[model samples]
Target: MSARYWALIIFIGSIWGTSFLFNAVLIRELGPITVAAGRVTIAALVSWLLFFALRKPLPRDPMLYLKLGLLGVFSYAVPFTLFPISQAHIPSGLAAIINALLPVVTVLVSHYWPGGEKIKRHKAAGVVAGFTGAALLASPSLAAGNEHGELWAIAVCFAAVMLYAITLNVARSFKAIEPTTIATIAISGAALTSVPVALWVEGVPHIERIETWAAWIAIGVFCTALAFQLMYRLLPRVGTTNFASNTFVTPVVAVLLGVSLLGESIRPIHLLGMGVVFLGLLLIDGRILKIWRKPVSGTEVVSPR
Candidate 1:
């Protein structure tokens, strides 16, 4: 990959990483449902504008719309709300560290899918390590035995990440759809699901603070909308293998932003947990092992022309 591609990948990761910050900020002022609803609403509007500007038509199949609608609810609406709810209790940086488990969970879930990627020996070990790290992160609350809210919040974050992994697995069926179209439809559906619930549960979302507006706009536009646009553009050029690097970069940026800018403090145990989780991710990625593996005597190395 070129320098431009590397920069773009990092930029996308950085943008996504700040979403934790935005959630922490927004959750202070708004209900979790309202915060999520507002985000998807803004993103949905932007997506519609792009849909028209780019001259992309909606999918013709009714079944596809049904699928996308379900995805919207599960993928965006539920998890978006859950993240804010979780952040209300836990530090944004810790939440970000937990969020890193998404890909690992995906690997575990996809193994059960028909014709999905089978679990290799390294992948199995990686999954075990990933869960072990998660247990480490959860240990403080578990040991305390009284901080149920914090423990529950951690579980909720894991649940949200699991939803994302499930959504990704299901979204593989959308190979026939344009990435932009899928996003527009899914986000639009998310808005539709979340808006009514927000209105019912949270009322009209009165915002008196300017900071709230700023945070909401940043999350909606940059984190949700523009990030989706950037990802689709880069995926074809960089390939999914390269794009997965964002998983590593995002949490690091999130941790830094949470500590420095947000004035959040983390324990040494949290750092150790994060390190273990990352080690698990590296194992799952298999790049290090591949680089070190020596070829068998009969094996052939095929060079690209």
Candidate 2:
């Protein structure tokens, strides 16, 4: 990748990492449902504004909306709500740590799904190592006997990652649609899904704090809306394999922000688990190994496709 692409990926990763920090702030005054609802709502609005500004043509197919609606519910509403609920029990850093498993899990899903991507030896090993790290991260909470409901929260976060993996696989079926349109419609569907649920359950949020409002807007605009735009821009040029590098950057940024800004403590186990997960991600990425494989007898080493 060029310097410009690298810069863009890192910037997107940093912005995405701050989402957990913003969620922590919003959850102080907002219920999980309200937080989720507000986030998708703002993101949807901003996305539609961009959609119009870009002068993109709308899809006339009704079935497309149906598919996008399902994407919204799975990709945004449920997982978005679940994260806040989990963050209530666990630190934002821990949430991000578990959420980092998306790429690994997606690899696993792709291997099994019909006509999906096949796993190579490195990716298979990556799947094992990734789940092993997940187990390590969860061991402390599980051994603590769920006294603080951290175990359940950890499970919920894992569930969210699984949903994300599945959504990613499903989204691949939308090859004919523009990425921005898919994002816009999906976010709009999430807004439509969550707002009613929030109103019904949370009974309308009343926020007076300036910081809370700022945090909400930050998450919606930067984390959700802008992040999607960046991903769509980079995906075509870099391909999914390179784009997956963002996963590694997110957890590190989340942990740093969680510790420094949110005043959360990180355990040694968290660091160890994160390191193991990074190892697995590196294996899947194959970049370091590619560098290590030197040419022999003047024959160039070629990467596996």
Candidate 3:
């Protein structure tokens, strides 16, 4: 890959990573349903407008609609709901640790997909280690106050990350469909689902305040619309392996914004948890030093062209 490509990935990771800060701010004044609803609703509206301007046809196949709807529900609606819920109790860093399992979960999910990446011993080890870090990170939040209740929220974060992993694989099916189509279908469907829930639960998102409005805008534009566009552009280049590496970058970004912008604090355990999680992901991906030292064998050696 070119340096430009690598830089793009890092940039995208950073933008998406900062979403935790945006989400935390928004959730302060809005209910989970309202925040989640606004993101997909606004993203859907914007994407569909773009598609309309381009005269793009919506996917005709029923299966595409089904995938889009499912994608919208799990990837957008549920996870959007989860982040704010978890942030209500736990810090974003802890939520990030639980999310760090994304790569490991993606690897595990790929195994069941037809002709997907074959699971190997190294990947298996990575998955186990990564999951361990996730468990450790969740511990503090659970232990602090009504541990079980806090744990339930953290569990929602876990389920959201798992769903994200599934979406990473499932999104390949959108190759024939326009990227906008997939995003449009998913976001629109999610928006519709969220509307009723938001109305009933949150009642229109605290419209009178400035910061509340800012939070809503950030969720809708920055977190939802812009982030998906960036993801679409980069995913094909990075492929899944390195693409999953974005999770490693996201938490650091999330932590910085959480602490600096949201006035959230960090402790030694959180830093230690970050280290342990990074170590686990490194282990999961395998030791670079060992792989570098080994010489290419069999028919794979480079030949003079």
Candidate 4:
């Protein structure tokens, strides 16, 4: 990967990683559904204002809007809702760690994406390592309290990852449009689609807690809109493989956020697990470790049909 790609990776990883901290803080204050509603609402409004301010016209094609809706529902709306619900059942740290499966899911989904990255053995091994790290990350939580609940919520986390996998691949076709515009459409759709449920479930949120408001604002502006826009901008330039590598790094950053900012304790096992996971990510990345693994010659490319 290029240096620019590496920089982008760290930037994206930090933003996404800290999202767990945001979720944990806000969920405590506002509850899951309400927190999600507030997040999407805030993101939609900010993006819309930015969209209008930039004087960017909406897509002339209505079909694009439809596509955006599908992408939004799958990518942001469903996963956004399900994640918090799962977090309600599971711990936020565990939820974030379980989300470590994203690269594996992304690789699996890429196989079906036309003109996308090739899935190879190293990638598979890396996915295994990532899960190992994730398992280590969640092991204490899983072993100690409410194993069934944790397991159940982890299942939902997997579903959310699948949705994310689909959305990342779908964004490839949206290259004709700016990432910011696509983000605006997606968040707007999510806000509108989720409003009824939000109203029915939570009814006008109080938004009294400063921590809750901070989390909501961060999610709306940084995680949802800015992060999506950044991901979109980075993807075309760096290619999806490098962009997807953020999946490997985000958990580490999340763990750091939990420990440092939130004052959560970090166990030795967690560190050991992170080391193994990093090794796995190296296996997946095809940059550094591929050299030692030696090169495979005579590559063939087939178009997705």
What lDDT tens digits, residue by residue, belong to model 1 across residues 226-246? Answer: 898788779889976678778
- Model 4: per-residue Cα lDDT over 1-305, one tens digit each: 67877988888887888887888788776757677777888888888888898898878888888889778877887888788878766555556666766767677678768887877888888777877776776676668775557666767877998899888888778777887789899887787778778789788777667878778899888887778768767877887667767766677777777777877666677677767766776777778765654554445557999
Runs off by more than 4 Å, candidate 4: 1-5, 89-91, 112-118, 132-148, 266-273, 293-305
In model 2, which range of ten residues has the least summed lDDT?
289-298
lDDT of 2 by residue, 160-190 (tens): 9999999999988887789889999999999
lDDT of each: 0.88, 0.90, 0.76, 0.76
RMSD of candidate 2 to the truth, in angstroms, is: 3.9
TM-score versus the correct structure, for each prediction: 0.93, 0.95, 0.87, 0.84
Which candidate model has the greater lDDT, 2 or 3? 2
- Candidate 2 runs further than 4 Å off: 295-305
TM-score for predicted model 4 compared with the true structure? 0.84
Tens-digit lDDT track of model 3 for 157-258: 888888898877777777767677777788888888888888988786556678777767776876687778667767777765566667788888888888
lDDT of 2: 0.90
> Which regions of candidate 1 deviate over 4 angstroms?
294-305
All candidates in order of TM-score, best leading: 2, 1, 3, 4
Clashing pairs in 1: none
Better of 2 and 4 by lDDT: 2
Deviation in angstroms for 21 in model 4?
Answer: 0.9
Candidate 1 vs 4: which has more TM-score: 1
Candidate maximizing lDDT: 2
